[model samples]
Structures are given as structure tokens and as C-alpha cells.
Target chain A: MTVLSDIGHLLLTADLWHAALAAAVLLLLPALGGVISERSGVVNIAMEGMMLTGAFFAVAADLILHDPWLSALVAMVAGGLMALIHAVVSIRFRADQIVSGIAINIFATGITVFLINRFYGLQDVGHLPPSELLPNLQIPLLDQIPFLGRVLFQQNVIVYVALILLLLVHVLLFRTRLGLRIRAVGEHPEAADTAGINVYRLRYGAVISSGLLSGLSGAFLAIGISNTFVPNMTDGRGYIALAAMIFGKWTPFGAFIACLIFGLGQAIYDNNSIIHVSQYLLSMLPYILTLVVLAGVVGRSQPPAADGIPYAPGTE
Target chain B: MAASSTAAAGRPAPPLAASLRRAGRAVAVPAGSVVFAFLMGAVIVAVTGGNPFAAYQALICGGFGLLCSGGENAGLQVSNTIVFLTPLIMAGVAVALPFRAGLFNIGAEGQLIVGAIACTTVGIHFAAAPAPVLLPAVLLAGMAAGAAWAGIVGVLKALTGAHEVVTTIMLNYIAQWLLRFLIIGGPLQLHNGFSVSSPIGAGAHLSTLLPHDDKLIVFGLPASVYRVHVGLLIALLAAGTYAFLLWRSSFGYEVRAVGQSQKAARYAGMSVRRTIILTMLISGAFAGLAGAVQIAAVDHNLTDKYFSDTTGFDAIAVALLGLGTATGIVFAAILFGALHGGGAVMQSDAGISGNLVYVLQALILFSIAANFLRTLKLRLPAVGRAAGTPAAEAPAGALAGESATALADDEGLA
Candidate 1:
């Protein structure tokens, strides 16, 4: 009995770090997309669809190509293509950004299912073998440390890359004039235009960047986290990431922490004494947390002034 | 000058005509797009070597006309249709309500399922007594539970400044899981089976109405035709209540005011937080009621599949179709119910892919959303900002100032 309890305790304790890692990966996609959103002055709500599409493609590639790395690459490309459609519809045609994003999601979900069913003769896909997976990396000295080693050091490449991107994003946004321009366009594109920055060009660039990052998230989820994909597998993580982004008040570093909080909430629901609750309800934890944060927080960190507003040249 | 005065003349017929024209425009894209999409879906079914018409027939018969495959044209068919329509109505309202406030409540699926569970618990536990007392008590409990679930999101948005679209969507998954837990491990455990289900006590299950008959009566004739249940009445009442709240009350006014312009509403001295929270709660309650009715009236026991299904999300499509009105919700629900009813038919007999329904629905949403955006009118107070495009015109009685931002750049690249 004591041994069982101790094992249970260890599992529970270890789950927290696992939760954080998962949450961080989830957070990485939206934070990356949002950084671009703030830069270009739009919200990337279709992230759920994009990530789902990428996950499907990642698994599809691995199944077809039998190469995990190549599959991940293909997934990224697929994600990029999905985002590109969104950019064109919302940014170029001057469609409502949120509506456009939703459309992209609907499109991606429907298209992926339709195509996969056609190609594979069914809905579900086969899993990739271990040799086809992304190999995890370990930091030599640091990986030998106690708690941090397992939590931070000995994770897959995506986690390390996500952390590195977090810092790099900070530098790129705060240090570079281009970052200033992206923020400028996001907040007030008319002002950016006045300042000689091409608002159209900058906004387009931001949305594409969002696509790339979100795609990476999807690819990582399929290839690194798991070696398979099912229909609509990302299962609202993109939306959860959206919550994390807002929870962190839309700042990258802040979003990382917020994502971790969401991850913790997810872990708690699973590990809690309320073991009788449905997994469906348990999955809603992060969303519930996001709602709490959104409702509780003041409108302190506002989106750029022109964030969802379309920028037709000469209108302002 | 002459044309301008003519445009202004005698309570202009132009607005009505314009709206009609806009409505026409609205239906066009969806019609074309859906036709094309269905054509594609048909191709899919054909490719799969299924007869499209046979599938459509099967879908209609299976989804609405019968509980069991052989039950078609039996007394139970009509009851089945009403059974399917009940939650869809509530969910449609749930989706539409948020949309009216320029919000989206994607958590309806979660809210409905949880609400259903809450009602089922009360109904079952309380059912050790008389029917009349237990029924009303369960209904109230269900409503409260549903309201609480939805109200959480409302409260979150009010306090934290989060987007309801994302949060509600996330909450949906949690709700599904929670429903599963309750069913499989807790009070909802079934009577000796591997399936996760509950045993609702006697007198707690919803009773259907056939006016003068207890058995299924069709059109006041001989055979048992499905009559409506108390849920239909409750749904109707909810719709009427929403209409009253949205169009007539101060709170509704404030909600609309906030949705139109939160900054302006603040300037107008309206309590934005209270309105956001209150509206979300009310809408959520509606979703919860949907679940209650489904459990108490339709399925006596809980199923995890029902909790996690797309009904709540599909309600969003319904709400969009309904123009965010309660009356609209009813029609939207029926339309969606039909599609759901038709899905099996399309798949098995008609040689049209069952997924065509989703494609058509998505097309319709895209069309409505596009038309909704295209018809808005946004004019700035400043002189230099008055270059109004036709896409920004206000349709009669349709709220203006969605004066949407053309957020995309359309650089459709390779």
C-alpha cells in the first residue's frame, strides 16, 4: 500500500512537468501567431484549423513518406498553405478577419477529412514507428540534474526550440525597428502608413509568420508528441493556445506562463479526486481558465487599434 | 441633389428594397457554393461506389422517421424527429444569443451536455416521489445548472477581458469530459452494462403530448404520430423571452449598445461588465435548458457521445442562419435537424457523401457571414474618412458599424 501511494505520488508530481511541456508546445503556436497578429494588426482565430491540418498532414506524410522529419516538414508546408488562404481572404480581400479565420478552420477541417478519406479509403491514419520519430535531445551536464533535468533538459527538440524561440521573439520584437513597425501597424496601421511603412506588406508578413509558427506546433504535436493522427486531432488546442495568449495578456513571455497555467489546470482535472468527471469536461479546464482570466482581467493590454480592422489603402 | 431628396422621400421604400436586394445577394453565394460543394460531395460518394439517392433516402428515414432502422413509418418516427429537434433548438438559441451581442458561444455543446447531466441527476434522485412535483423541480434545476455553466464564461469575459469565442470553445471539451466522468464513474452509471449510461428513475422521464391520446396519435387520426413534449413549449417560451429581452429591455439595450461599440456604451454610462456577464449567463441558461430537455424528455440516460457531439457547435451555424433571433433559432434548428436527418440518406443511398452537409453548411455560413459583412456601413466622424463603399451599407434593422475591418491582404500566394 505504501509503495503504491509513493508511486502514485511520483506519477502525480511528474505529470505537472509533463503538463507544462505540453502546455508550452500548445502555447508556442498561438503566441507565435499572436506576435505576428500584433505586428500586422489582426487576430489569427483559425489557428485551431491550421494546427489540425498540420497534425493530419504530419501523420499523413509519415505514413506515406515513412520519414518523420520529412513528414514534419510536409506538415509545416501544409499548415503554411492553410494560413496563406486565410491571409488572402482576410487581408487582401478585406474580409472580416475573425470570419475569415473561422472559414479557414472550417475549410481545413472539411478538406482534410474529405481528401484523407478519398486517399486512404477511410478516415483514420496509420501510426509511424519509433525510428521515424523526432529524436529527443538531452543537455549533457544539465540533463543530469534532479527535477529540472527531466522537466527542462531531456525533452524533445520542439520544447527546446520553443523556449529558444520565446527569447528570440523577445529580442526581435523589442530590439528591431521592424518589430516596432509590426507593432505600429497592429496598433494603428494608418499611423504606420503615415510613417512610410507599407501596412499591407507588413500585415501580410505577420499572418504568414503566424502560419509558420502554428504549423510547427501542429507538426511537433503529431511527430514529436505522438506518432499518429486521427480525425480533428488537435482537438481545440489551437483555441486553448488562443486562451493562453490572452491569459498572458498577449505578450510572448506572459503567454508562456499563461500556457503553463492552462497546462496545470489540465493536469489537475486529470489527477484530481473528482475522478468521476467526464474527460470531455476535464478537457474544458483550460478554456474555463481562459474565460476566468478574460473576464477577470481589465482591458489593460488592448490589441492594436486596427487589429481586426481591414486596411484598404487611402481609407484613413 | 434631386436623387438625394428622392432617396430621402416619404419614408423611403429603398431600405426595404435594399434589404430585399441584400437578402438576395446573401442567398446567392451560399446557393452557388453549396451546389458546387454538394456536387463535389456527390463525386465523392460516386467515387466510393455508393448510390447517392439511396444514401439520402436512408439519411432522412434513419435520422427523423425512425428510432430503429425498421421503425420507419411507425408511430415512433414523428416522436424521433421532435426528439432530435429539441436540443438543436436550444443550442441554436445559445449560439444566436452570443452572436447578437457580437459574441460567439461555442461552448453550447459543453453547456448543453453539463446541463443535461445536472437535470438528469436532479430528476433521477428526486424521482422517488410524485411526477408533477418532480418534473418542474428537475426543470428548474436543469435551467440553473445550464445557466451556471454558461455564466462562467460570461463572468470570465466580464472580469478578464478574454475573447468568448476561444474560451467557450475550450470550455466545450471540458464539459464533454466532465459528462463522461459523471456517467462512467459517478451517479450516471448504467444498469449492468459496459456502455456509460444512467438509470433515470420512474416519473422523471419527459412525457409527450398528443392532446386527447396517450399513445402516438397522428393528426388527430388513428395511428400513433409523435406529438410534441413540454420541451417544445419551454423552447418557445425561451425564444419569446429572448426576443423580449433583446429588443425591449434596458439590459438588452445595454447589451446591444456594448456590442455595437463598447467604448460608446461606456460613454453612454452603461455597465459593460454587468451586461456582458448577464447576457452570457442568460444565453448559457438557454443552452443548459436544451440539455435538460434532451435528458428528461428524450434520452432517459446519459451518453458521453451526446455530450461530446457537434450539436452545440452546429448550433452556431444555426444561429448565424437565424439572424440572431429566438424565432430564427427555431427555424435554424429545424433546418439543421433536417440536415442531420438527411446525413445518413446522403451517405447510404443518394450517392452523395454525408460530409456534404458540413460542406453546404460551411458554405452557407461563409455566404451569410460575407453578406453580413458586405452590407455594413461604417462612416467616420472625420471628413477625410467618409469614403463609403457599398460593402459597408446598413441593411434595414440590421445593426450597422460591424463596419468590419478588411483584415486580410489577399496576397493568395503559392
Candidate 2:
């Protein structure tokens, strides 16, 4: 009962909601990435690796260049390169996408640590100065609004960017001709190929785009939310994003809602000082919730029809 | 009939040649993958301004106890490799069995963790029992716990048509958090120790192969320095059991039939759902046995080291590289065990990060999955097109087909 009261009181505070939105945005970026990649018929379980790679390069670049924007760009490129390996192996060579994804994850973990050892002599990556970190934007007048202002207006620049990207992805995936073609290709590549859609080109583009989004999320995590890059700093956020994608049934808006739920859990865990619950047990909630969703309590969540199948031309 | 008889007599030489070709092709892809990975690893090391040769030399010295420049003992190193590979053999069987059923068991890590937890709980509770009673109790407890953990996945998959890959991933995280909860502040925590459980009783320990005696010296070191335990024999027995279960049992036939085509299996009067559930139960039991043995033979308690344990993940590569055969799995386990043993030496002696092992592992996975050598048209004379295709295609095909069938079933339900 005390725990319930604690959570209830915490929910009413603007600070909790503010932190929740920020965390949700963090998960939202990769969840959106997952949505794009899986919708293109490529099973992308590699966002965790891509995000880790992005986070490492982002911190590394920021240390060298001292510019957050440039560092973010470097991060995206690094993530895209990792994804390119996955795309080439799974899409071009017709390999198992899951195995390729696993390889990407393992490779990212190894390369990042190996680079840290080479550059920093087995020491920690030094923290960035406040001036070098991504700035928080205070929307002028809107910031004066009571509770919603702190929750929505005065937030990290990346949070705003992510919210905008969320809208753009929603519109792009459902409201455009390109979106239709992506869905068609995912549903039936052979039929789409017959319809003159370049299935390979679309899949490659979708996969790379997922990497870019995941990279941006990683940059936000390393440079905005935190100042230094710890080993495995992303922890399992990328995987949580995967859960969000599935919980939302692969739609951008659906995934966003799922992210908010998981993000709330993260926010609550962060405020564990007041809540009388084990943080570790609290941490398991997202995965448990996802499992519940998968168990059909939330209705069946179907994937793209041709997802995970290698596109062999002229095959049935 | 006359022509057929003449051809058979004339082509008598072809039988021996064909068998040789068959054996050659079996060894080619996995060998090629390892070579490709090592070459790529060398390139990565060189590009990063490190001496690849020095690093590899240290690795070889550490793994096989040869060409040592660091004054490490050859006998001790071999013992270390054996210890490292012991659990991997069982875990490899865990992954391999599920693959034979067309189910990807990515939750081996989770299963192993719960098994460790259960084994610790039982061993601690039964501290006063004799070795004859406590030893088997702890191991069976671990197996039961692991099976129950994985049974949730099997039930969901069988009833709801949920994809095993996604469910397994979720379960892995859940088990990780559960383990943390158990040891940190839960009942399993030791009195004064941090992030560790109390050691099990002496009766629960799986005695080392060598007598624990500081006075006895072998190969210029105390016999106690060698940590190789009786788990090696258990692991080998487990491998033999896996082979027998997979090749000679009626259950194995059902599993393979379901793996080949679920619809055909269902048409042939086998319950696909039951086989799916049973395969996961058995698979999880193997993984659980791995954890129980590690606790009994090596660690003897739940420790922070288990947090970063990669034995289950390494088993995936072992199963793949071994081509899901008992002998192949043993050989692959040895290679991986050697790499792990060598990694520490490489880090200390060559000033290279031990993470290079993981990089090499990832490269091997990429090469194997993509069949890069085959794609480059570097086919060996023994690898006929048909023979090479099945080995590379089976895993991918089975996974894709299983999910497609699951999706179709879901649509019918809807």
C-alpha cells in the first residue's frame, strides 16, 4: 500500500513525467528504427549493437572534435557501417539475418572495448564538459506554462528532434507512396518485384535508415543524457526498444505508446530512493510486460508477411 | 540390367572417391570459416597498429602451451583449457537439440543462470547430507529449475504461436534480473559477502581429477594448481547421450520430422506442439546441467563472475561450427575453450585486449552464415553444389519456415 501511494504521488509530480518523456524519447529512437527495419522484411535484432557502436563513436568523436553535432554525425556513420555489414551479409549473401544481427552485436561489443584499450590504455573514456554536451532547448513563452512546459517544452534538443522524427516516421510509414512500397516489399517481395519495385534497394535503404536512427539515439544517450561513455552504457535500452516495437505492433505511433510505458518504468526505477521496491525486480517489468503482450493478452501482433525470408528472385 | 551391372563394376573406384568427397565437404565450410575469421582478425590487429603475430603467438602459447615467451606452464594451460571447455560441451548440446527441432533456444543463458541459482539453493539447504545424496540432488534441482524456466517459453510458443527468438530474448533479461535480485538482497546472499552466495557444502563439490594435495608436485607445479574436475567426464557422457538421443530415439525422429516440415509431421500423426514443448524441456535440462557442473566443479557458489558469463552464447557458435554433431561439438568446444584460455595471456603478454576473441567469434559467425568462401567461388574439389547447399541452408531455411508456419497458424486463429 505504501508502494502504491509512493508511485501515485510520484506520478503527480512534473519531474517524474519530465524524466519519463526523456527516457521514452531515448527508447523511441531505436523503437522507431526497429519499426522501419522490420517493416522492410529484414529481421533487425541488431539495434543493440548499432546503438552501442554509435554511443562509443559519439563519445570518441566528441573527445576529439569537441562539437556535439559533428560527434553525432560520426556516431551515425559508425552505426551505418555496422548495419552495412549486416545488410550485405543478410540481404546480399542471403544469410540468416538473426545470425548476422548476433554477429553485429558481438562485433560491436568487441571493437568498442578493443578501441578503448588501444586509445585510453584500459582506462575510462573521460567525461565531456557541460559546454560540449547537447544543449537543452527552452521554448520561449511555452516554457511558462504550468506543468506541461517542463514536461514537453524545456527538454534536451535531441528529445525534441526525436519527437519530430516520430511524427515524420508515422507520416512516412503510413501516408506516403514510398511507405506503401516498403510495406508491399515486406509483405511479398516476389510480388513487389513483379510490380517493378526495387525490393533490394528499398531493403538496403530501410536497414541503413534504421542504423541512422539508432545511432542518433545512441548519440543522445552518450552526449545528452550522460556526459561520459561507460562500457555497455546503452545497457539493454536497444533491446527494450525491440520490445516496444513489438508491443506496438511495428507502427511508429504504436511503438511510441509502448515506449512511454517502458519509459515510465525506467523513470520509476530512477526514483527508487522514494519507492520501496528492489530496482532489479523493477527493471524486469518491461520484459515481463512484453512477454505478457506476446502471450496474446494484448491481441496478436503479426509481423510483415515475408519478414526474415531471403529474397530469392522468381521464387514463390 | 547388363548395362547397369557393367557400369557398377566399372565405377567401383567411384564409391571410395565419393566417400572421401563426402568427408572432405563436411570439414571444409567450418574450417574455411575459422581461417577467414583469423585472417580478418589479423587485419584488424594490423590496422590498429598492433603486432598481430605477437598477439597470436601469445594466444597459441596460452591455448596449447607451446612457444611460450611468458614462462607459463604448459600443463597448467592445458588444464585451464579443459576446465573452460567442460560446461561448453553441455551448453552446446542445449543449443544443438533445439536446432534439430527448428526452435532457436536463445534463452540458454537464462536457463543456465536459473540452474545455477537452483543448484546453489539446494546445495546450501542440504549442507549436512552425504555426497551421495547431495550431489545428485543439487544437479537435479538445477535441471528442474532450468526446465521450468524454459517451459514458459515452450508453452507460449506452442499455445500462442509466439516466435521463440523474441520470447527467448525477453526471458534472458528476466532471468538476469532475477539472478541479481536473488544474490544482492534476496535469500541467497551470503552473510558479509557482496554480490555472492554462500559456498555449498563439501559433499556437493565435484572433486577435481587430481588429488587436492599441496605436497604433490607434477610438471614443476603443485597438483592442486590444476583445476580440471570430474565434470570433463560428465560432459563427455552428456555428449554421448545427446548423440544417442538425437540419432537413435523415436523422439529424435519426431523432432527432425517437425524440423523438416511441421505440416508433414502433423499429417504423419505426430503432435507438433508436444514435440516443441518436449524439445525445449530437454534443451533447457542440458543447459541447466552445464550451470550445475560449473558450480559443483569450478566456482562452487554464485558469484559476480556469472554476471558476465558467455558460456551459453559461446555454445551457439560451437553448435554451428560443429555442424550439430557430437564429435564436431567436442572439437569445436576445444577450440573455443583454447581461445578463452588464451585470451588472458594475450592481454597480459602481447598488450592486446582479450576482446579480440569476441571479434574473431563474430567474424566466424558472419563467414559461416554468409558462406563467404562459397560466394567468392573458392569451392574445394570435394564440395559438390548439392552437398554444400544443405549444410549452409538448413538453419536459415528451418527458422524462416517455422515462423512462416506460425504466422499462418495465427492467421487461422484470428
Candidate 3:
């Protein structure tokens, strides 16, 4: 009984809610990134790198701008810039999309480490001042509510923004003409192009959107839970987001739920038995989750017909 | 990875003559991709802060300079590269093989771990045997273990219609956890004060090669001590044999047929399910050999990081670069080996992080992927794909007589 109550107390803590909020943003971003990028018939697998890139820029921006909101925007712009690199290489150079995505991840990982070492002159940097930290927006009446308030209301702007992005992605993908064109491109780029849709334009749009959402996700990582930045901080969360996207069959809502579950899985696992579990086993949570999700959605995931396939003019 | 059927909606197969043409065309592109890949690598080195000439020299020196110095260190360097490449080559081939059949096997890391666990078990318990026999037994045991690991993925793919990618990945974690549990608790327990390593038996070790000259000279100076073994020969033999199997056998033909047109293959009486499972098993067996070699030659015991890093995921890149041919995979693996070998030197000499090599590798992969996407005007970056394009990639750059860009399909082949 004591152990059970202890577990309960731990679960209901402020830190747990923060972790949950953190996890939810990560899960939702990639799927939204996918949909937005799918507008051009591409699925950005470099979300990992973009998220990492954003994390770095978010801290850098916060350090310079001295405003958290400005820092968040900087993260988005940085992610977009990273996505732009991907876009040029993949769209123009006709590189392999998956490989291109991997390059982004690798380069981002390297550059971040290099810059951090140069800037901080150490293995890691200390946290920014409280003014630079994202303040929680607690609802007045909702604060009176017990568990619900803790879980939902008292998060930084990024958390609330994450929820808004989820709905926005769903609406953009399912309800709007822009979404239709994007889906069409993903489903059949050739047909979409033939129907007078500018395929390159769509792809550019998608890559840009991937940058934006992934940027937000990155911001959430640096400021939402912890007020410090670290290299490889996003770690494999981006890949897990990819898994969640796949598990959700590319639906924004589905991905949100999957992300939440993964975050919870991380939260529970992180708090509950990480130490007790084998270090190797514990480290492999995201990959395992990825595999499970992949398996679950395999055969069912009808990725846009042209998801990784680039668009060409004369080719069949 | 869309499902391919041997008998799409019901139709007979095409003429054998066309199959011959496909066989020829299939051989051509990967050959081209290889030369093209090398050229790209050269270009990338120039674009970075380093000279390609110096980097290449460093790479060549790093890989073979040890050998030129004479006796043991050279042999050791050779063997280490080969030993490392052995698993990479096997995993590369494993991935590439299924790829020809239009399948993706991204679970090589997991599968390799499972195989290693089994190999480690052999190293820990089995004693009282000579080097040759014990090593062979361990190798076989590793093969069986790895094969079973791949087989699990195969079975899942077959029965539940699950994607091999997901199943194999999940299985990798399970295998990893299970091995750790077994190693910590029961039969293979290290039981040695918090160390997560098993006590490997001396008898179950690889015989020393270059017994006399274990330490060799580098650049006219005798420096660096290491040993070499028979693993290099094994790696070469494995690559050659895989090449033979891919091009010479009826099974190879069936695999190609299924890959090119599953429905047609099915109409022609090919067993899609069996092939899928068998392909994964073959991949596993090869991976197991890699594990055995790593144990016998390098680490000599089951340790933690042994299961993790090695960039087994990058083997997919090697396979893609190789375009699924044995010789291509061998060269690609060697290239990766050299890259890894030179990474430390590059970082030390240039004051760049060893990860710069990764960045360069990623650049090369993404650029090629970018080249592929140009056709579709869809651009993205390959962060560190190292290599990409399972199909048509090798067709252009790998084969001897033919040449083409492997990046075509990755960009907009669909």
C-alpha cells in the first residue's frame, strides 16, 4: 500500500505533467510536419535533425533576444532553414530522400555539438535566466481543478501551441483545399501535377511546414520541461515521432495520441523502472516503440503515393 | 515498402528472354553507382574544410598504412577492418538481397544483437575445445542465433502481414533485453561486481594470425601494436560466396522475379511467403557470422557498447551504395571501415571532431538523395543516410560493365 501510494504521488507530481506535455508536443509535430510537407509529395524524415537544430537555435535566440517568444520563433526559423537545406538537396539535386534526411540528422548533430563547444566552451551550458524561461500560463478557474488543471493548463505557450497545431494540421489536411492538394500530391504526385498543381511548390511548402512544426517541437524540448539546451537533446524523439506518425497512419489526431502514449511510456519508464531495467533495454525505448508502432501500422500505412518519390516532368 | 504479389490479380509470367535482359540491366546500374559514389565522395571532401587528396590519403594510410609498416599491426588493421566489415558486409548484403525482392530490412541492428547474444553464450560456457573447432562451433552457433533472429522477423512478416521493418526493430529490443537479462542472471552471468560482461573462455578464441609480427612499423617507424587473424579471409570469402549465390543460383532468379513482379512470380509458382522468411534468415545467418568474428577477433567477450554502436543502421547505406551485390558491399564496407579508421586521425590532425566524417558521409548521402529528388523537384537533406536507394542504386553504380546514377529512384523513381 505504501509503495502504491508512493507510485501515485510520483505520478501526480508537477514534473510528471511537464513530462507529459513535453511528450505530447514531440508526438504531434512529426505527423503535422509530414502532412504539411506532404503537400508537396514528400515526407521529411529529417525531423530529428530539424528538432535538434531548433533546440540549439531556441537557446541561442533566447540568449540573444532575451525573450522566450522570440526564442521560439527563432527555433522555427532555424528549423525552416534546415528544412530548406533538405528541400534544395532533395528537390533540386534529386538526392535520395531518406539519405538526405539522414544527412540533415548527422550534420545537425555535428554542428550543434561543434557550436555548443565553441559557444559554451564546455560539455554543456547552464540554464538561462528566469526571464528567458517560458512562463506557464495557468488558467485561474482551471487552477482550482485538481488533476485536470495540472495536466492541461499549467504549461508554457509551446504546450498550448502544440494542441492548436494538432487541430490545425487535421483541419489543413482534411478540411481545406490546401490540404487536399497536399494529400493529392502525397497520394499521387504525377496525377496532382497533371491536374495543374505545382508539385515543386507543394514540396517546398511541405518542407517549410515540416520546419515550422519541428521547430516548435524543438522549442518545447529546450524551454517547456528544462530551461537548458543540450546537444542531441531531442535524441531519438524525432524518430519516435516518425514511428508515431506511421503508427497513426499519418493522421494528425492519431499521431497526437500515439505521441502521448510514447511520452507517457517515457514518463512512466523514466520515473518507474529506468534504473531497475537494463541500461541497454531502457535506452532502446524509442527504437522499440518505433518498431512496435511500425509493425502495428505496417501494411496499413498508405503513405502518400509520392511520399519519398521526387516529382519529375517528363518521366512516366 | 508496398506488398508485391507473385500473381498480381492473376496472370502468367513473361518470357524467359526478357528475364535475361532484366538480369543484364540489373547488373549494370549498381556498377555505375559505385564509380559515381566515389566521385561524389571526392567532391564532398573538397567542399568541406579538408582536402579530398589529403583525406583520401589519410583514409588509405589509415586503412593500409599499418600493413605497409610490415608484420602484425598491418595485419591487425587489415583484420580489424575486415572484422568490422564482415558484419557490415553481411548486414549490407542481407538488406540488399531482400531489397531486390522489393523488401526493406531495417532491423539489422536488432538482428545483429540477437545473433551476438547467441554467439556470446557460446563464448561464455563452451570450453575444453581447440581454437579451430571451438571457433567454428561458435560461428555456427552465432549463425543459428542470428538466423533465428531474422527468422522471427520473417515469420511476423509472413503470418501477420506486418512490415519487416517494424517487427525486426521491435524484435531487436526484445533480443537486447533478453540477452542482458540472461547475461546478468542465469547461465551467461558475468557475476563480477557490476560489470555487464561475460567471462569468455580462452579455448573459444580465434587463433592468432601474423604470430611473429604482431606489431608493425608505420611510415618507417615501428609504432602501434595489434594482432591479426583469419577473419579477413573469412570476410573476403563471405563476400565472394554471396556474390556467387546472388548471380549463380536458381534461388537468386526467384528472388529477382519476386522483387520485380511478385504477382508474375506467384503466377509462375514462386513461394512469396517462404522467400520472405528465407531471405531474412539468410541475412540473420550472415549477421551471426559477423558477431562471431567480432567476438573471436576483437572484443573477445560480450560487453555493453558491443551491442550498440557499430552503426549497424548504416549498413543499410552500405547496401544501398553497393546496390545489393557482394563485391559492391565488400567495397562499401571497406570504405566505411576506412572512414571510421580515419575519423580519429582526421579529428586529431585537423582539430575537427571525428563526427565531421559522419557529417561528410551524411552530406554525400543527402546529395545523392538530392540528385535523385531533382527529377521530382522535391528536395530534402540526408542528415547521415551514409547511403540510400535499395533498388536501382547499385544498378547504375555497382556492376562492372554498366554504370548509372543510383539516386534516380530515390528522388522520383515511383
Report the number of the highest-DockQ candidate: 2
User: All candidates' lDDT scores?
Assistant: 0.68, 0.88, 0.66
Summarize candidate 2's per-residue lDDT along A1-316 as a digit string, tens digits.
8788888888888888999999999899989988998999999999999999999999999999999999999988988888899999988877888878888988988899989998888859899999888899999999889999989999999999999999999999899999999999899998889999999999999999889989988999999989988877888888999999999999999999999998888887797577656788988898999999999998988889878877866333
Candidate 2 root-mean-square deviation in Å: 3.2
Query: Proportion of native contacts in model 1?
Result: 0.36
- Cα lDDT tens digits for candidate 1, A1-316: 7555643664557546866676676667656776667557776887788888888888888887888778777877887887787776666656556656766777767767656655675666677788888778888999888877778888887788888888877777778898888888887777778889998888778887777778778888888878887777787778777777777766788788877766765665555563544565556566666655555444444455666767776643
* Pairs in clash, predicted candidate 2: none
Greater-DockQ candidate between 1 and 2 = 2
lDDT by residue for model 3 over B1-414, one digit each (tens)?
Answer: 111232453554465754665665554444444445556656645554546665555555556544231232344455455545656777777677767666666667766676667767777777666666777788888789888888877766655455554466456556666666666554566675543667557766765454534266643434334444567777677778677767798777877766665556666777766776787788778777777777776677776665445455667778776756787688778877766766555444443445555655565565444444323332235433323343234331221111011112222322
lDDT by residue for model 2 over B281-388, one digit each (tens)? 989999999999999989999998888788888888888888888999999999999999999999999999999999999998898888887655634556433333
Better of 2 and 3 by DockQ: 2
DockQ for candidate 1, C-alpha atoms: 0.30
Q: Provide the lDDT at A161 for model 1.
A: 80
TM-score of each: 0.80, 0.96, 0.79
Q: Tell me the deviation in Å of residue B142 in model 2.
A: 1.2
The stretch of ten residues in a row with the least summed lDDT in candidate 2 chain A is: A307-316
